[model samples]
Target: MATATATARAATMARGSGAADAPALMLSGVGKRYPKFELRDVSFALPRGYIMGFIGPNGAGKSTTIKIIMNMVRKSTGAVKVLGLDHVALETEVKRHVGYLGEEPHFYEEVTPAWLGGFVGKYYPTWDARLYKATLERFGIEQSKRVKTLSKGMKVKLGLALALSHRPELLILDEPTSGLDPVIRHDVLAELMSVIQDERRSVFFSTHITQDVEKVADYVTFINDGRIVISDVKDDVLARWKRVSFPLPLRPEARSASDPAGLEAGVAEARAKVEQAMRGALGRAFAAYKIDGLTFTGITCAFSEDVAREVGHLAGTRPRVLPVSLDDILVAIVRGSEAC
Candidate 1:
C-alpha cells in the first residue's frame, strides 16, 4: 500500500480537474428524521477528481446520508445533486454514472461470481468484461466460487471489482475496509487510490477508520450524532486542531476537608472555576476536556499562541500543545458534542 503522504500527493495531483466550477456531489440542508435518530441539515460537496472521506462513528447517520444521496432512502428535507444533476429527478441517469459499494453487500448466495457479473453487467452500458476479469484476477477471486463460499474479504473484493468494472464517473463506498484484514484493507485502499488517478472520476468514502481517511482523502466531512462537526481539506483540518494538556491545581483545603459534603462542594467549585476559565478564554471553540487526578486534558481547535498564553495563565502551567491525528479529532468532536 502507498504511504499516506504518497496517497495525499496523488489526491493533490488529481485535484485540478477541469470541472472545478461544479462539485461531483453536493448536498444542501439534507435531513432525515427517525423516532430515535435524525440526520439534520447535513451539507458538503466532493469535487471532481478528488476523494472525500465521510467519517463518523456508528449510528452517526453516514449510511443514512449515503442512502439519501443514492435515492434509496427518501429525505425529509434537502437537495442532492450528483454530477450537477438532481439525484432524485435524474435517479436512473445518476445511477448510470455512479458506482456504489455497500457496507454489507448481498448477492444471490448460490450464484458464482461469473454468473453474478454477467447478470449485473447487463445493467451497465459501459461494462468492460476484460477489465472485470482482470480485476477479479488481480484480487485473486475465482470466477467459479459461489457467493456463499467466499470469505468476507473476498466478498468485498468482488464488490469492488464489480463496482469498478463499469468505469463509473463517481464511486461511493461505505465502510469498504471495515471487516477486512490489514493486508486486504490495504489492497482495497490501493485500488481506490489507483481509481482516483483518473481526472474525471471521484470517490466518496464513508468509514470509521480515521487512518484510512488520513491516508488518501483530499477532503473530509466529519459527522457525529447526526450532525456535521467539520468539513474541509484534510490538511487544513489536521493543522487547525490540537490536543492541549495542563496540570490542574488542587485546593489544599478541599483535599484536607474531613466532611464529605464540604469535600464534594470544594471539588465542584474548583471544577466550575476551571470550566469558567476555559469558556472565558475559548468562547464556544470546538473543544473537549477531562480531568485526571491533578492533570487536565483538553482537545481544542484553538492552538494559536494567544490561546496558549491564556490557557497557561488559567492553569498556572504552560499548556502542552500537540498535533492530533484524525482519530483523536473524531473522539474529541464526539466528546465535545456530548459535553454540550
Candidate 2:
C-alpha cells in the first residue's frame, strides 16, 4: 500500500507541476571542462512556473551547460536533475519532457512539417494532437510545407510547435531569436509567453540577446568563460552593474599636471578625459545620482543607477554614483575577466 501510494504521488506530481516539491531542473556543483575552456561549479534551480534566461558571451558555457542537461554530453562532475529524475539515469524520460531548439536547427530536407510532426510526435505517449493542431493553425504553418522550404523564423516556430504539442513539462531553447527580424522575434516572444499560461510549465532558453531576456525571462543566469557568473532575476542583474567617473586634482606630479590650468581647469580636463574613457570603456552615457560630496563625471543618465555605484567601487576612486546597464555589466565582467 505504501509503495502504491508513493508511485501515485510521483505520478500526480509529474502530472500537475512537472515536479511539485522538486525543481523542474536542478544543477548542483556541475562542471564540464574542455582543453581551453571550462564550465565550473554551476548550480541553479528552476521551480515550476519560472523562466530562466541563460545569457553569456560567445564561447561562454551556456551551450555546454544546456548540452549537459540534455544528456548530449556527459558531465565531468556533479549532478543534473530534471523533473526530479537523474538526467543520465533517466535520459529517455527526461528527453520526453524537454523541448529543445538549436542556433542552427536541422531537419531532413525532404521531410514535411506534417511528416516531421508525425515522426517526432510518436515518442511521447501523452502527446496532444489537439494542441499541436491548434499551434499549427495559430502559427499559420502549413503541414505540407517542406522543412527546408520554410524560412528561419518559420522553422523556429515549427520547432516550438513541435515542442509544445508533446506536452513537455519544460521547454529548453538555444538561441531561438538569433537571426530573425524584429517582427518575427516579437511573434516568437509572444508565442513563448503564451506557453507560460499553464503556470506549471517552464522555459529555459540560452541567448546573448539581453533585450529578449529583459523582456520575457523572469530569472537569469549569466555564464562566461565556461562558468556561471551571475544568476538572479533580470532586475537584480541590471541593478548591480553601473558606470562612474570622477575628477583628479591637477598637481604638478599628477598625470594631468603638465597643463597650466588650476584645479578648476583640471576639473574640466578631468571631466572630458573621464567621459572619453568611460565612453570608450562602457559605451553609454553615465546616469548621475545624488550623494553628499560625490559627483559622477562622464556619467550618462539611465535607469540602472545602482549599477553605476557598484562599478564605481572598482575604479580605485569612488567618483560619482549612477546606474549601470546589462551591456555595461557585460563590459565590466569582460574587462575583469579574471574576477569571473
Candidate 3:
C-alpha cells in the first residue's frame, strides 16, 4: 500500500535525476533472528536492469529475506535499500513503483476478479485497465468468477495479472510459479522476460525452481540454513563449481581374522580412509560426496590447476570433472552445509 504524499515525493525525486546509476536493490549484512531459526550476515545486490534469482531450499530464509525487503517483516540488523531509497524510511514511495506477488495471495472469497481489480487498481496511478483486462483474458481467468471458485493455478494467474498491470519499475516475486501448470509457468516466465527488456526495470525472483532461474537470471544468490553461501553472477558461479567422480579402492581382506565381523570392519576401515583422502584433497571447498560400492562422487567449488593436481594425487589418477548445473549446485551447497 503506497501513500499519495510519498508517491508524489518519489515522483519529484525522479524528476531531479541521477537515480539510475544506483542498484535496484542492495542488502548489506542483513540478519534476522527468531527463536529457532536465524538469517545471518546475508548480503547481495541486484543491478538495475538484470534479474537476480534468490534461491535456497525450503526453510532457508528465502521468504524471510523477501518479507524484509517489502517491510512486511522487520530486520534485526543491517540495511536494505530499494531503488536507492531506504526500504523503511521511504516505504510507501518505494512500494509505489514496486510490484509484488506472494506465493499465496489471499483475496476476499466473495469478490470477483473484475471487482478485485478495480479495488486494487486505485493504489497505482499508472494502472492500465486495458492491459489488465487483456492479461486476464490471456491467462484464461474469468473476470466474473468469484475468488473462492478459482483453482490454485488460476489464483496464481490472477495475482500475476494484478502485479503486472501497474507497470512497476521493479518486480519482486516470491514463488510466482508455485502452483502453476507447465504451460502457465512458461507464459509467466515469458512475461517476466518481456518486462526486463525495458532497461529501467528489474526483477528479484525468489523460488526453489532452479530451471526457471537458469533460463533467465543474470545473477544468483543462494542462502542455506539461514545464511548466504553463494552470491555471484550466474556465469561465474557455474564456471567455478564442478562435479568430480572417481573410482573407490577395493575393500581390504581380513587376513589375520576368520570372523565375518572382522572382514566387515576391514572393509569399513578402507572406505573411511578413501573418504578422508578425498576430503583432505578438497578441504573447505568440498561441497558434497557420495560413495557407492565401487565409485565415489564429489562436488567441489575449487576449480583450479592446484585443486586438480591434489585430486589427481589422492585418486592416483585424474578424476572425471564435469560442469555442474544450477540444480546440482544448489543441492550440493545445501547438503554440504548440513554436513557441517
The number of clashing residue pairs in each candidate reads 0, 15, 0
Candidate 2 per-residue lDDT, tens place, 1-340, comes to 9999899878875674444667888999999878888779999888777788888888888888998999888899999998788899878878887778876778888888888887888998778877887888888889887888888889888888888898777889988988889998998888778878878788999888878888888888877787777787777666555444553423334444655445456556545554454544344443332222224443343325444554454334555545655665665555543222
Global lDDT scores for all candidate models? 0.85, 0.73, 0.84
- Model 1 Cα lDDT, one tens digit per residue, 184-242: 99999898899989887999989999999999999999999999988899998887787
Query: Which structure among the candidates has the greatest lDDT?
Result: 1
The TM-scores, one per candidate, come to 0.83, 0.79, 0.84
Model 3, residue pairs in steric clash: none
After superposing candidate 2, which stretches have Cα over 4 Å from the reference? 1-5, 8-10, 13-18, 244-260, 263-265, 268-322, 337-340
In terms of lDDT, model 1 sits at 0.85
Candidate number achieving the greatest TM-score relative to the actual structure: 3
Ranking under lDDT, best-scoring first?
Answer: 1, 3, 2
- Pairing residues by index, what is the TM-score of model 3? 0.84
Pairs clashing within candidate 1 = none
Better of 2 and 3 by TM-score: 3
Residue 210 lDDT in candidate 3: 92
- How close to the true structure is residue 10 of candidate 1, measured as C-alpha lDDT? 60
